[model samples]
Target chain A: MSTIGEYIASHAEMLEAALIQSLPPQWNVPVSLRESMNYSLMAGGKRLRPILVLAAAEALGGSQAAALPAALAIEMVHTYSLVHDDLPAMDNDDYRRGKLTNHKVYGEAMAILAGDALLTHAFYSITQCHKVHGIPAERVLSITEELAAYAGARGMVGGQAADMLGEQGLTKLEELEYIHLHKTSDLIVFSLRAGAHIAGATTAQLAALTDFGNAIGLAFQIQDDILDIIGDEKKLGKPVKSDEKQQKVTYPYFIGLEASELKVKELTEQAKKALLQGGFANPERLLQLADYLMQRDH
Target chain B: MSTIGEYIASHAEMLEAALIQSLPPQWNVPVSLRESMNYSLMAGGKRLRPILVLAAAEALGGSQAAALPAALAIEMVHTYSLVHDDLPAMDNDDYRRGKLTNHKVYGEAMAILAGDALLTHAFYSITQCHKVHGIPAERVLSITEELAAYAGARGMVGGQAADMLGEQGLTKLEELEYIHLHKTSDLIVFSLRAGAHIAGATTAQLAALTDFGNAIGLAFQIQDDILDIIGDEKKLGKPVKSDEKQQKVTYPYFIGLEASELKVKELTEQAKKALLQGGFANPERLLQLADYLMQRDH
Candidate 1:
């Protein structure tokens, strides 16, 4: 049997090839714009959201091919967010994924446009889902709307605004959770839901997966906070304690490290419980993936 | 009989009301982000794009009510583009429509976030198209995809990159045309096409409208160049000669003033010819709007 690690690696490789093909053709206009977009999009990373999308679809017996467009789209959205969040006006980070950031390579203007293009291009990507797998236009449209809603203002952007504002003032635990819920969990929840949606999962199945995604996403973020405090630079692939340096509110900071670790454990268990309760034909791989995410360091 | 100016005025009022209602509700998250978006969206302008969408749909016998969601969506996309385009890293303008720009009223960070939010929210708004007018999910999906593609890298963003890069050196007439075609014409074309799509315009009609829109869009832009050179800044509601200040190339700069005026008249005639040849029922208003756009100072 293929291990979850192998599954993730294979899927990521598949995604990489597909993403490359999606770039503007050589004869396409504005070659430099496409290059700037590709610079950040093709940057190496775990491809966690896309992987989760695939896993969710597989567990629900959906066509992975149909889901591929959405998978690429979410990754694009994620990559765009990273590009924007790393701007000097935002996090001001010079590096991402252990390399110089897009702005660092392409300049601030190009970086901004690159992010804008990626976000806009995501909608174009969703239209391809139907063409690739013979999915209906209506299904693809539903997916398009969902991706935008979660990634847009009322969700991720809103959370980001609150997070930035929070940096200047002391944040309560409730507000921080609010930020985490929208900033991180909403997109993760959308990923699972979108996968299930592609496969035509039942409403209850979709709800359960969303819940599972929420728990795991929250756990994943808390683990990130823990790593920021204690992870080795080589393993983490970026500087640690930058969150502390920024005086940002984090799980480890808001609660003690021990409590935060305990929260991770609790949330992971909750995720597994949600999956089991969902009663899919086979959710073993999803369960394993949840466990893997909870323990990952970088 | 209502003149074209009166027709435009009534449509603009309707669009303004509809757009205001689309802003986030009181309980929505990230109050400041919505404020920033509203600041730009509610700023006064001609509302030309949304009006075109509605007019195109009307000519195709589509329900205005059915087209409301899409009309608002195109407007939102237009507003978002203006906001981003006016940023310090882009056109870097301090004012639009005779008022302070988004970045000027809000900070640069909020302006960027607001633009991002507006772009993302447009997809969410597309989801409501079906609900508003019984427009089919499949049709709405097609519209969503079309909007993204035209507004995206291959279109507007690509043009923007070219426009920015063109600033660094002397630009050829062909290169300047490329920039204008993608940057301005594509979205305008999409706006007309989207409206037709909403009303189930025949393929021939869509193609004709696309050509009509293209002609008008190019004409519209050439006139803008003319205005930038000799038009009053007070009426234009922004600085004139800024394009020259930025050392940007233009139609007037490339071709003499008399020749540029002749070009606008030629293109306007082309737009009317497309509509007539396509057999649009009651093309009078569209024709008038075309003339008005050609002659407008602001």
Candidate 2:
């Protein structure tokens, strides 16, 4: 059987083409706005959230075509968040993935607009499930509601706010956990849930996926923190010790590096266990993907 | 037999209460983000868009209770746009409706997060129509789609971008009209259409309202220009001629003051005519609301 890396490599190319096709016509989008939005979106990444969406759907016996729009929508939301976070008033990062950030290439104003446009267009993309794949309107609406819940004030945005606020003071273990849960895990959870909803997963199956998503999401973020200390700069596409330079609180700050690594392994096991219990037609890909994420050094 | 003034005052109070009631609990939203969002939302204005939603629903024999969530959603969208527009990277305004702008009160970072949170939460609010009013999933999904279309990159955001770009060069009357049509009329049209959709308006009826919305939306904006040059400062709650100070292109800039005033009257007449042609259980309130908007100094 092919490894998860082979699966990801094949699917990522499909996603890249689908994203370009999904953009509204030039007449619909203004010339400069379209250019700015495309600039950041076309910049490549791991496509992790969207890949999770496809994997979950496939595990539940759904077609990838049926899940493509939702996968695209979630990616747009993720991209928009990154764009906004890199703004001068926010994280103010000059680079992402070894490339100049959205605001660096486009002006701050256009970057802000590009982010807003991407976020808004994400919902528009979700609606395409009905047109493109014949997903029921009821199911689409449910997905839309859940997406807004996870992406909005009470979800990722709230977490970013908490993280920013935490920057001014000492962040306790519990507060850091809260930030990680909302800022990272919430969207991850939504990605899984959206894909499962498209596949008509039962409530119990959805619960299992949620648990699996939460565990892996936290593990993924912890891995990010651990990588900051010991990761290769060329592989990471940015310098190591960024959290240290910023004096940012991290898992490694609270727990020792070895303990943090242990936590990631433990969470990965928990995630795999949840998936095994999920009773899917095929969970091998997801199980392997979880292991793959944990084993990655970058 | 009461005047439109009384109609506005009575409905405005109900809208104010509903807006406050619609906010998510403190636990769901971070403290600073909530404060920044509420700061701009509660800064009172005429409540024209939400009221139009109610008016259109009523005209088609629908209950206000059934349309409140959508009304609230549109208002949130409008308020979020104002917040983002007031950012230092954008319009850089210090005040809105005579109160400190969101960024002025909350730091720039929180203000940006607040705007993002608010924009996202608007979709969450729209979903409430299913829970609060028992609107069907299909209808709600359609409303959600239309809302995204009008408020998204190709809609209001596109208009804002065009307006910004127009600042660099001489703006012809056609370009100015394009800006006003999308920037102002699109949301107004959506507001009316949303209410009509909730009320089960026919295709013809929706078309009539769209026409009416476009005419009055332009007229309303032109009135803004006229007021900038000739309006009372206290009534407007801000300095007059600020548009002139910015050297912004306005209707009066292209057509001259006397012609601009005549244009408002002409468009107002056309709007009233469209409403008269629209078949509805009751159109008196909407008809009067249109006139009220035309006659307002602020």
Candidate 3:
């Protein structure tokens, strides 16, 4: 088996290729709406969610083909969130991944519709996976249900709502924790578990995977907070200290930088351990992913 | 058997009750976001899409229970579209169904996310149906794929994009027709066809249903255009001449009001004939629905 880094890189490239190819032809959408969707979706990013999906599915002894649709679906959902978040009424950022945000390029209305279109397409993409594999329809349905629960108001959207409201202030560590867990962690956890579920992971395996995802997800967020504080603006490719400027509640804000870093390290280790317990044979990629996430300047 | 109108009304009430009941409790979302979703979904309007699903399923001899989840799924998609449409970036409407539009109440950001969440939840709802019926897993997967296709860009979203662009100006009648067929007709057609698909309708029956749905869908849009010109705002519960004021293109604009009205009558007759050819029993409700659509004050 390839090293985890190599596995992730190769799969990431494949997923990116699929995403680019999967986009509706320019003729398929209005020039304005298509431009908006392509702008954000194709904007350069790490494709982390898709990578997570691929890695988890492979870890569960599933074929990459079996997991490709889910990978695309996760990316679509992620991209949709970013597009909406960039709207004038939301985060109102003009740039993302070092380029103009969807609304900035396509106008707000087209951007809004583009995001809606992408999100609706994500479900369609997942539903089409059954054609690739003769996997039972029940499994597909369960995966769809899980994705919805994790990404909807009860999960990601719920978390985002709290994050927006809590931007004013989060008095308690638990409240901050709740916001991060739902807004950020839930979708990451869903990505991992969904891949495993589609690959038919045993219940025990799924539980372990969920734990691994949760730890990494939190660690990932903490690292983000730390990066926002210390990272170079050019390297990060977006504003630094913007959270502080906005007075957004964050881990480093509440726990201090030293404690936040420690939490990241501990969570990374815990995630590795969980993967090991699951007898995941190709642990090198995920291990590297943990390190890359924590150590990256961006 | 119940008269189709009686069956439709009762089923609509049941579906509405289920929808209200299914909303995430206040505990689940920040009060603001929860209010946004509920505000638009619960706003009084005919539950036409869900009713179509129930009617189609019944027409194919399927139990209403067997089709309820699909019914809910269709409504969610419909509601999501409306929320997105009302965004400042989209149609910028301030009211719908005689109530404040989603963005008007929740602000654009929450409204955008609310729509995203609702669209995501729709897939979840459909998957739950599989759990209830123990339907073949493969069938569930297929149904999900079909539903996604009809609701996503290649269907509804694709149509919407064209509509948005066409509103600026459609150069040709065919271009205008394409926009209305896709934007307005696709989901309506899908709503009618999906229930029958779930019910295991015979190939011939499915074909007939598709024909019936397509005719009605187009007819419905034509009626909408005619109403925009001649209908009373007080009865319609929306601004009657708003489409004209916005310079939005409509069938009436392209074909003239008299021709548009004639086309609607022709298509309505065609729809009824298709239902007859499909051997649809108890189609009284379907006929009444056609009448109601054409004659509706609002």
What DockQ does every candidate get? Answer: 0.77, 0.79, 0.68
Question: Which should have the higher lDDT, number 1 or number 3?
Answer: 1
Query: For residues B47-165, what per-residue lDDT tens digits would candidate 3 score against the true structure?
Result: 88889887787776776787788788888888989898877767878988688888877777788778887888788777766777665566566667777777767778877888877
Number of colliding residue pairs in model 1: 0
- Per-residue CA lDDT of model 3 for A1-298, tens digit only, reads 6765566677778887898766546435566666677777789778888888877877777766877888899898889888888777989999987898887777777787788878877877786667767655666777788888889988898888888877779999999888888878888888888788778888877788788888888898888889999988988789999998988878988889999999999999898888777776555666677777777664
Q: Give the poorly placed runs of model 2, Cα more than 4 Å off.
A: none
Give one clash count per candidate, in the order shown: 0, 0, 6
Point out where model 3 deviates above 4 Å. A1-5, A24-27, B1-8, B24-27, B280-284
Candidate 3 chain A least-lDDT 10 residues: A21-30
lDDT of each: 0.85, 0.88, 0.79
lDDT of 1 by residue, B1-298 (tens): 6988899999999989888878658536687888898888899889898888888888877787788788888888888889989988788888887889998988888888899988888877877887556788777877888898888888888888888888886557888888888889998898888888888888899889989988999999999999999999899888898888988789988888899999999999999999887677667778888999998974
What does the lDDT come to for candidate 3?
0.79
Q: Write down the lDDT that model 1 would get.
A: 0.85
DockQ of candidate 3, scored on C-alphas against the true complex (2 decimals): 0.68
Q: What does candidate 2's lDDT look like per residue over B11-119, in tens digits? A: 8899888887677665577778888888888899988998899999999999789899999888998998898888999999998778889988888989888888888
TM-score-better candidate, 2 vs 3: 2
Model 3 residue B280 CA deviation in Å: 4.2
Task: Give the Cα-based TM-score of candidate 2 against the true structure.
Answer: 0.98
Ranking by DockQ: 2, 1, 3
Chain B TM-score, model 2, reads 0.97
* Steric clash pairs (candidate 2): none
